[model samples]
Target chain A: MSRHRTTRQRGSSANMLMTASASAGDDHSDSAQDPLPSWNEGATKQAIIDFVADVTREDSPHFEPRDRRIAVFDNDGTLWVEQPMYAQMDFALEELRKVLPLHPEWRDRQPFKAAIEADFETLLKEGARNLQILVGALYAGTTPDQFDRLAAEWLAAAVHPRFERRYTELVYQPMREVMAYFRANGFKTFIVTGGGAEFVRAFAEQTYDAPPEEVIGSGIITRFESRDGRADLYRFADVDFVDEGPGKPVGIESHIGRRPIAAFGNSDGDLEMLEYTTGASGRRLGLIVRHTDAAREYAYDKGSPVGHLERALEGASSNGWIIADMRRDWRVIFPFDGA
Target chain B: MSRHRTTRQRGSSANMLMTASASAGDDHSDSAQDPLPSWNEGATKQAIIDFVADVTREDSPHFEPRDRRIAVFDNDGTLWVEQPMYAQMDFALEELRKVLPLHPEWRDRQPFKAAIEADFETLLKEGARNLQILVGALYAGTTPDQFDRLAAEWLAAAVHPRFERRYTELVYQPMREVMAYFRANGFKTFIVTGGGAEFVRAFAEQTYDAPPEEVIGSGIITRFESRDGRADLYRFADVDFVDEGPGKPVGIESHIGRRPIAAFGNSDGDLEMLEYTTGASGRRLGLIVRHTDAAREYAYDKGSPVGHLERALEGASSNGWIIADMRRDWRVIFPFDGA
Candidate 1:
């Protein structure tokens, strides 16, 4: 059996010693004294503090190097707005419109038919499998370079319908700050979600400063070949791997090789990742963003349609996962607001 | 098509640089450096000098942050001896003896039968395919933690048959210096090879200062499960990906994202990786270790049973690859001899 380090006291803040000082321009500088400045003093804030303190203090014996401090996050609700439908679904619908003339048969296909006809409710009913079909049709049979260029173009112009902001700007400001904070502290941050890895990787570096290599999401199969005396990696129509539920930890192990010291999620889909992280040997932290503010954001957990949060909420307390009360814990929801 | 950078001209004192540098180290260091240090003043040294200088110069137009300058290396012939047979083959042979009692049927199997009878010639005739079976038998069905421990034990004690020294000690000292130099310059170095990723990863950190996350190699199938209420990654008998040739570029793209500005290799297997690196639209360098010395290091290429060099040699001149002439370049070959 792998050696398991003893867990530290649950709420102890004594072990929070700073390792490398944050460089200038750190997002946390505005509220460095509080450590959890942007977060309200609550269960979520306390859990973060306790975990960080334990892992950072060398004297406490839980200290790990900055390199080993990997932290993975789910994108949709945890990082940005997921309500009204996934942003990628919107892009897929638009793409289908543009490509329909070339592939007239797609107009009659089940999911593609729903997508091309703008029957989003029907598309939603078709669920994840339909989404996979849409992604495979849109992304496959192109070189990775070509796919990247296409994704970048889509992200540049695609605006959220409800927010009327570029999809890039729709990212949650608090989560963005959290990412920056983790990075500044030497944590190798990664985005592991059910979203298409290639799609997210195209703009992730520009939007989050997390490079494509660090993003582990659902992936399509790729083949290598030389075309015109140059090597190209071409995406195939088949799904190679999916990053959801049990697949989350599998993806992490396969790609990153290290168990994350911390994990952040918003729904039950991420519960497995949280379980894996918190159940790891050393100091561990798991945070669940509870969307509880209807005025600023959609507020529903067990009843939410987009990112259903049932098991995650029910097990948060017992599993020592911090369920962030979105209405209270977050001072700001999106970057545009001056909270 | 991907942009390709022109190969930089070698420094005027390229030959002097390697020779002079070789004499500066201890006896073992000199021995290691002598094999390749005095190489004829040519494109190889120039590539090394130009790339190093550009990366080191803060004022250089092509300068990158030291931290972003990552370099990956293949282990076997690139770092140490791969003659007689691959190093892992030696380990497998020893493991066969240990596991023979448990698998009595091996005595009747063709390749295993020969292996049990100490018929090394028959094992060689069965060739690469036979080795694969041996590797799977020796490495499969163990927990990652268990494999790590076993690998560590073998690495610590296993010695090269001809050299009669620990396999770890056979690593070229000049390469060791390169690793340190890269680290000192703030580059995060990694090992990406066709060899078993986990096997190399188990000892790379202790021997090369490359942490587990930084090491990327051919991966085995792994499963994530709760064992005794603790999560662990279990190694399975299946191969996940073979990180060789074109797979090198794919692996790097998937794992590191950014193209490495510099790359080093010893054989044709690394040609695709070097091509990928030098093809990036920036200052880049590619160096190949040509085993030209039969007296000191048993040098043979093309028809050689180990690490053949056919297409790589043909492409070296046109592709602007620096071929390290082992016989002329270095004053010594191993770390044990004085410069």
Candidate 2:
């Protein structure tokens, strides 16, 4: 539920029925031989292929043992649509709506009042602070298990307004292929997100092929209590750590205990993570997913309310970061767009 | 350096020169055939063997998938020796000695002076509070990599006084065998310690065959800062979270994000971890190593200054936790005691 805000409007809706043939016509393809079939043949795709080959090849000077092959990816805009708002933000807003009846005091409060009435104008005026207040109140007293259940239930029934499909179904096909490709090469792919860890954990395994432990993100403080001879953890409203911007490096060190060889992100929130990752000695990769295809997916960068990508985009060339232009590099966006 | 204070004195020193020939005469010999050859034929060994078989057997009602077969072990006494003091406490004390000259004001400080002078009586009188002050100061501003180097260097040069062996060599051979057995059966073994995570991670991979990510423990707050275009994390004096007693379950949840099917420990610090692990539905195992072999290892369990084993020991029977008596259950205490 945490994001910056701007006045940019949502772009064109994705053509869900559009076949892979549409993108294929304008993009080069070696779908028959490529491990990343969803990716068109381009410098961006070649960078990914060549990096994997270098680290995994036994005789190569850049060869890294399997255990050291760690790769991290930012969630929101990089893996899925974050144009209208962050998916977690939408989930939090809906949660606020559901709980508004119980707390009438929320009807008069600034953030709560705007949020309860679905006033995007007032909410966007002060997004981060308002969203933090709402999310903190919404998730405060729930246990991790309770939060997981809520997230799972919400994700199951909730549909993205633009796509008219389940949020889980809106994950990028090419990113999923990239994750699978990394895993197949013995690289441990971890989803390092700015979203709540528990929220992402609910569907990370099924949606992203990442296990619960592999997903690191922002977290609420959790207290361990013994209740009726049973051990339980209660998530508190206080923020434990935020796994965004500079926190990405701290979270990676705390959770993974190793520097990732490759990092992928879509915004300035991931700038520090990419810097830490690709800055390490030896062959490394830093990739930025640029949402340039407005026809297939929403597009916004510097001025976008959510996932504003100005500084990282500008520094990509200097940092040796690959910027994957969605319109040019990807053969398909969502899985429904491909065979 | 965090531990309970007790008035009990150190137990008998281990006979490092005592060969396998001595114990082999008294213990059963099926070394070539047994997976856990260091474990004697007993109810404790059988309990571990049976639990692994039941979960791995496809026909068994208790069968669990490979990914769910998680086994966690407490580090201090369960995996290695914590006799005269906890090994981490010893490391902390040694670090204090090296840094004493740099902090002249510490010469007059109660805890610092007492620790520097090797005044065990005063240090042990108010152990937890005094040790906390010393440890907090010692590890305050160092980066994780710096801390790792300090711990690694100390561990390499440090030797256990009684056994005249390096602290790493003092690890329990029986416990090592059990870890190997679990891994061989597709179980991921993790060390859920009450000690500093960075301290354990320095040697975990080499000494215990546990990767850094698998060693969950207490941690200091870390901050990420960018210096010279490089991201670095600096450890703060403030304690982030302690992975002991009630915090064990909390740490396990934060790090592994799954319930361990099997839990192993040797003290009250692991009481809640054992409770949580064994309390879960389905096939579960909880085993505690009772340091009853004074001649082979150290044995002052119930009233020991470190690794106190009272509440957990008393509740073991009612909780269906297996108590592995070190004297009777282990054929060899350390790897040096056996082939």
Candidate 3:
């Protein structure tokens, strides 16, 4: 029951990506031209292009001044598939299992043991914090470089259970084009998420072209220590900052030192970010990605365990935030799945 | 007794900036041709060019792959004068006096009384936290927009006592040129300072061409709230993150998400950032501004009150960090004052 549903959502999952590939290979060399081919040229797509054009045009009243054209995107749901489980949570669970041989003590720990043994019911009973704990374990004492390498290796190999493609590949092609579109128009794109900052940073450049500094998210503490006459920063097993809900705006002010001109997010966790971003004085944009595609990707919104979307779904229209219906707005759900 | 001295140090304070204006008005065409005209042709200047050229060249083995090219700089002495107290501290002190009428209670408060009365000895006795407390007052209840306005206005009018020029004008012409040089060569320049992040961010784009997002510095805690349907973030009187000494590296990682390929600093606070940046794998560059121009700019190193530079002075040559001698190497000490 999306507010907008059309032929864009009619295609089956099997030919989704292949269809996109065929179009992408044909004369899409110009950076500014054909930026959103994965998009079905609907009102949503037109709105984004029009906004960017207004801001970048020299004579336009909506022209974003120097140091003001910041674009922020939420990870997990907005940019990629975050159904059944968040890809990051899935990663953390896998990492916990891999280290079971070294952490025998984890076998006796409740959350760790449940996670290691794949006890989904007990893990679910423990609630969302179980994911944080697993993430902490994933960090532990690994040097930042080591962590990056580990994440890269895992992302390259790990495949989604349902889609049978790497989680990295599940990032929506339409959204990816949107990011590039922003970049081409002089907006600096940043990833503001509740997921681990370092974890997202590991593959942000490769997956989204957003390098480390451009990616802001939840992160644990880090301490600098010199060993063998060389300095290495070690990750601590404690939360330093969280980038969800209200924290998203705080994170933006703290790290980037400016209010973003536009923001993209999904779920209640992103509501505050959407409000904060679009609420700014000048012309601003706030977009919520409503996951409504079941054939191409998992679809769930209100009351779902992962990436619950009740608040945003209700507030999007009233807030004048554009609702990106995954099934209706996007031509393709994932990189591998075409329209 | 000084380590390096030349005719550049002989000029009295009055003529420092006058000499710089003569060359600045000249046609300095070409990005690479006259990058750092304020810098006397020396090994320090050449080292910077060589490192940038090698890393930026696609064919070179030392070429940085992807978009990992980052350059970080400490603001205080590295980019601007830290002598006669930091510019940010001075702003906080001024704000304290201006607000004394509203908060008459500050007249009895220990540190606040000292700051309002211009009791430098008493303020110094109260230590660094005194400045932070005053800064919290400067930020208290003021929205981000209001804060930006106040900071911008203050910087526009605030004049350096000795130079008799706006504080914004005190930024090093040589360093500014270097930042432009970096930008010209596809490098993103960032001001990684121990100064208040918001304070520095207010003028960073105007003075350094480093946008607000590109500026990283120390910060206090902030809370998000909405009033009159307008959401604004409030600064709290508590430590959030410090960007000094070892904290610089952590700040860099947290904000930028990667190690910088090049870093510039002055004094002991920047030693860790210097080590962190230069110590990264592949070709790297680290340069420390040595304040030795006594007549043109206030000179202090190793044991002076502010910006003491002892450990870094000893480690510079050994660590292969270039020492930019203010007296001998800089043709101009400030934008107004030339060698």
Candidate 4:
């Protein structure tokens, strides 16, 4: 039998007692018994176990449907490599180079000029407004379907310069296991991110096993109408809504209609989501995946220009949010060869 | 057995199934086996049936847990009476008269002046914006808990002008039956409305049996923090977000991560929510409650001064949305005096 099926069989038999007394240690031999063997034993692991235990115990006050145990995760740093620069920015820059011939004016525009010239510092100084402009320019005048196809194509071929691996392949294996583990336990996993909704949704299913509809993110305004005697929806660059920080909770509240019992993030961007999730009455779990291993992966946190983890760390302990120490809590980082 | 249980047992085991297959020409007696005999056999009945069918059919593609089947309803025209002005508006006007002594400037304000003189025509012309201003002014400066208590007190004694019954008792019997039916089938019912979230939450459980967190609505922003060595979250009059029109979908998308397969609305404000819900790829349903019987309830659509249904009616047939024809479909409207 396959390893996962064997684990499922053992889980059904051994873990069917519906009690809260399951050992909190990582001593269980996971060879064919636990599918999540790579997770480390600590606050992060304990939080997951305790929350799931309380929710699964029929006698516990917090017991809820295994189906209602939805967990939403921020994608950028939490799921895959977002350091150096956002992986999507790299893709946009490459696409810009390819499309430069068509848009000759971009060679002279300030930020666009800097982008074409490969000046990363100038781009950073421009901040959020510039980023919005870049996103609008990259995604404008394209149908959502076409944009998805382009995004999928870019993700398949794009490689991280530092790791020299395809961007899709750089996804953290431990996090992937977490998604699978949650699904195994009857939790509906969703990707709620600040990235373009259409952009991430295009490849989320193929990469994370999360379907397109389950993905929620920032979106451009779109209009539905008939074109050429067939129904068609046209996407425009006009700002629709931004899904970040407090907006994350707002987005989740608007789209899902049910508050998630669990949330995961890696930086300050996800602080609001974790706050909202943990603030919910009853058993809740909030986790932050801290990139603290520079050797295996990148390690800068509070001082890092990208995915800064300052305010989140300040409130982590007090708020009871688990900060996953990459070097200690994760047995593996990226699924890179020889890692 | 209880009356409902006895009636259910007396009918054929396939009573509900037979009712489902019966043509629209069948009278209310066809549903004699239905546990909720108080419900009328129009759009409200169809909505309940569609939702229950989708959630209960394990073999059907739309099958889902009863717990996930959340049904939200607007209060005024949907659950109660909006004719001769909204009941809440009357309460607000009364409260304005009582609070006018504190704020002397209100005696000269246009809308408040009209309100003081019972000039409802002027108030209606001022529209929703004026109502929002009044709510902000009245609801401000008080703690959220205090406001909730005040609302509860008002709800306890407030009476509908036309019905001569407690405002809470103005709820439609057919809709109430729908609520019970949904609950029996395992659906988590909610009240997504433009009413104050905390205000409606205070009395929703007592009136409609819907729990506090399940009620989403418009309200002032509040801060969750400690104050002067005591823990207190205070509500402020700052308009946070309006739960109407496009905001309904935005609110649903943010709070609930999963898209509802079904939705119900009575006005143009609910149009976006119905659109969003029905836009989902799978088997989805949307229903518009058309108030068409002036004797049982106020019949107004298209150009009605209150809760206009022009846009909704125009698109209902094309969108495949069920239009609840109150005159032809319902056997009763309100629960009080066996209406």
Candidate 5:
């Protein structure tokens, strides 16, 4: 936290796309025929449509080259549901319960015990590092196959407490459409998240249509070995890189070698990514998805534990970032709602 | 090196694709009309053809889903000529002369003096670390724009010492065809190189048709900052990640998330990547390029300073890795040499 605490709440995603007179430009010519049907006809929705139209139009001066039309999205809160705690965190807790029999001593361990009892207050008091260590210990040293099987199986079976739906279906319809829209317009969409890289990648391809290669996120160290006439790549418990805040841009540059033209995020964790993305030379969009729907989805800002949107929310206005008010701007919050 | 050091003096690229009897199959009828026309027909050539065919055919048990079709290639000796020193080394030398005026004291330094004097023996003696420090110093702290300008300018003007042609034109024709061949068969081609990523990406798109996003290689730390209402990403003089040997697999997992279906390289540095890629379940191809063509390219093995092909070559036989004999296997070398 101390390594990057300078700009607490001063930057976010931008919106201003160039218009092109190219013959094939904007087939859905007006906001009336907007592709983002899940979004209400508002400034936020308009900004998105305009940005996409401008970038894809060949004649636009601000148009990014097709290969450079990189759109990066934050996974947890921005793309899908991150409420009732992050899905990965939930997965971790569930794993803790399942693995408790194997680790009887974990009942006395601080973070492990806190996790077992679902003591949110104790877990928070114990802090991020302890939680990370516990999670890492739980998931580490497994071959890709073994980890994948466990995660995939858990994901298939696990249902959201409130929605009573499989977590995979928890994805936001608007975001899904946005991804499809970007792909149709030749933009390479990537998920740059603070969550586990492998965790996001496991089901992102099937859900978001963004493949494994396009995902950039936090990861642990991995080792390669040979066994039984086969090579094995397995995960270890050490943090390889943390793809959050300022680290977001670093990860983006390292993996993609190009700054994204568009970035979507919802917390202070995403502030630097928003700044890095929108701060590009020209016509960049930085979007902040403000969770404002308490009825349909949990809405908490400033300091609610999961996805604290304090600094970034305050910063969004200053940067002209589109604060997508979920309550007001989105027509449908979830896929099951059938807008 | 201890992390990954085994096998020597054997293993390189393969060829010979399968017949299109599977449901979702390659349209290319046979190896006689092979897409890799630049490669001389042999088991090595046939093996590559067969692997692509097998993995792409829907009915084949080994068939990879289209999204899982990732093919990684090493840059230096594998895709282009690394002999007479690496092309990047040539770039570094040229940069050294241009920057020598600023660092007159550098003449007293071992690696700097070696670089300034164009003394290959002394430079090699000073070893990789000192040389890396010199090169990192030469390129570091410059904004991505300035560095890009410098690299692109140098690439445009500089000519290969032996070939009297731009270094970009020195890419191997057979390798280029293989990239195209895999791409045609729905495999996404990526460069997983130990060379400087930016240097390769600056010209790779034009020369190899592998865009900046598709190019993965070693990189240094880069910082994103803002001044005069503009953002700049400047490279620092620190090694962020070296995509060499063991580090190659780490980079691939971090960036691409999924194991590549096929891996190609020419040096010991690529051993880990080769193992990581081909070691994955089901059908996988690991190809090594042996620089045995002295007439068209420089011939070196076991102890070449540029790309030492030692342990990897020795271990290839047991691993069933294909050894691409440049002299015997490649009918044509450089693309400029003609069809």
Candidate 6:
């Protein structure tokens, strides 16, 4: 149902971040033939390619059937930029700005007033509860279809603060290539985000090439109503499920009904998902997209309230998770960036 | 995870139910190639074929893309047998019999007492609550993985009383062919059931060719715990969501995240799913499997407590839903039945 077309043209930009290392063993000189051209040849990149090869090789003991090759990726920091502020937060605040005129009562309300005034301090203090309120207000009265349209429209227009590119264009090219690579190899790629499922579903198909059904995330309860022989679903304010931290594994189990063979995530929120994925009795891969390029992208880790990366960062070595340092591993950040 | 092998043979059976009529418009003469050979020549079969062709044919006004060609089937009655007793209920009772000795309190408990005594009269009066109790007792301390194994073990051994065959073999051959037909046409088939999700997921892939992720149903909350560096999920007695009647649409919306183009159901419990599927603006199809074959299978409609089929049966004509009368539409009942 989410059929939004992306506004940006890929393969036209000439903004390469880093060049491929000549010393690397893999043949990635032929950009047209490279499944992951955006990735610079490195240990991280080789590890990913090797894992895929091992799992897919029919003769290998690590070989997994096509049905069992399920790979889950966290959306926010893993697939796209979540800094400057979470993209969903920016969307919510923008929505609050638009609706503030109608809801005069919100002018005096704590979270609403703080959000309207661009009071980051207060909003951060309130944390997820503030986001929930804003989400409820943003989605009020609109059906999922209508909300999807609004999200798509906003995404088409909204630009990243630093990059000044459309939010959709800011999606990580390497991650996108990884998704496509997995998909090509008969692996089902799913976006297991901590963001709103409906919000991410809006442009997931267009941006990530993952279908709406494959994007599992936090969701609000939707009530089904039939009026005048027309079936409509209404979104409620109550949180149905929160897919973060420990909830990630729960959400994965509920939605996927099986442990993923591989998981790509960024923060501690994804630690459990990584654990669940790699803990299964099979050859599995778990990778963390560590934000370590401040010149190209904001680099914040354990100290950042948005995507805290302490626990998972600490456990990466012990768990054998491939930590992809953006500056070292990725040749290009966004799809708009050139090789 | 659910790698259960069915204990049955494909080509050895010689039992034939009824021969196909010579009046079918489509060529089904090549028995080896007919997509739905077990289906008799009828309006219901024709309608189903026509809808699928219309939706899949390129340049057709009704054509839907491969991704949008999602078809949902109700599990209990629509896909397989649930007449003499709901299969999940039978499994639960069998489990109750196994665990009844451990809990002496159940010996005096109303629902448990009635279940232990094989008091169908009292159990029927108790209704869903009894099943919930039985389910809770059955899955007490077992993790989802453990429960899946238990279910697979039970299904392999369980037999349908009337058919005197494995419950898996008693699956309607016509419906199986229809599922295969839909799948062949690039439609993603899903089992949307009121039965326990875990129970259905155990054999869905093997029996229906529907993966565990494709089977959405009633569920209990699963608690996530990390013990001795191993992640485990324990199923609780708490009801998370019920995928029955009104809840079917909700489950579909939550899991599938889009309206299915086609829906197949057998009872009034699927009324909402049918309405939700057809009410959407699209070329949609809704079909109800009416149990009118007393000679081949059990025949009970409105008065039947197991799968009451009154409201849906009455509304089928007005809703433009196809009613596949089991006795008339189906040439063969079970998979063991011949042409």
TM-score leader: 6
Off by over 4 Å in 6: A1-33, A101-130, B1-33, B107-114, B117-133
lDDT (10s digit) by residue, model 3, range A30-91: 33446677888788987887787778777889887534678899998888878777777788
Error of 6 at B220 (Å): 1.1
Model 2 CA deviation exceeding 4 Å by range = A1-32, A108-114, A117-133, B1-33, B108-114, B117-136
Reference-based lDDT, residue A224, model 1: 62
Rank the models by DockQ, top first.
3, 6, 5, 2, 1, 4
TM-score of each: 0.82, 0.87, 0.86, 0.67, 0.86, 0.88
Model 5 chain A: worst 10 consecutive residues (lDDT sum)? A1-10
lDDT for each of the candidates?
0.69, 0.77, 0.75, 0.66, 0.74, 0.77
* Descending-TM-score candidate ranking: 6, 2, 3, 5, 1, 4
* Candidate 1 lDDT, A224-313, residue by residue in tens: 667787776767777676677777887787677677889999988898899888886777888999888999888877765568789888
TM-score of chain A of 2: 0.85
**DockQ scores for all the models shown?**
0.21, 0.23, 0.29, 0.06, 0.24, 0.24
Model 3 misplaced regions, further than 4 Å: A1-34, A101-130, B1-32, B57-61, B101-130
Q: On a 0 to 1 TM-score scale, where does candidate 1 land against the true structure?
A: 0.82
lDDT of 6 at B159: 89
Which portions of model 5 miss their true places by more than 4 Å? A1-34, A97-132, A226-231, B1-33, B100-132, B226-231
Task: Give the range where candidate 5 chain B is weakest over 10 consecutive residues by summed lDDT.
Answer: B1-10
lDDT of 2 by residue, A241-268 (tens): 7788888988898888878999999998
lDDT of 6 by residue, B220-252 (tens): 788778767677777877768778888888889
Better of 3 and 4 by TM-score: 3
Tell me the deviation in Å of residue B272 in model 2.
Answer: 1.0
Q: What overall lDDT, based on C-alpha atoms, would model 3 receive against the true structure?
A: 0.75
Backbone clash count for every predicted candidate, in the order shown: 18, 0, 10, 22, 30, 0
Per residue, candidate 6 scores C-alpha lDDT tens digits across A223-322 of 7886565767878777787787788888888888878999999998898899889987889999999999999887889888778789999999998999
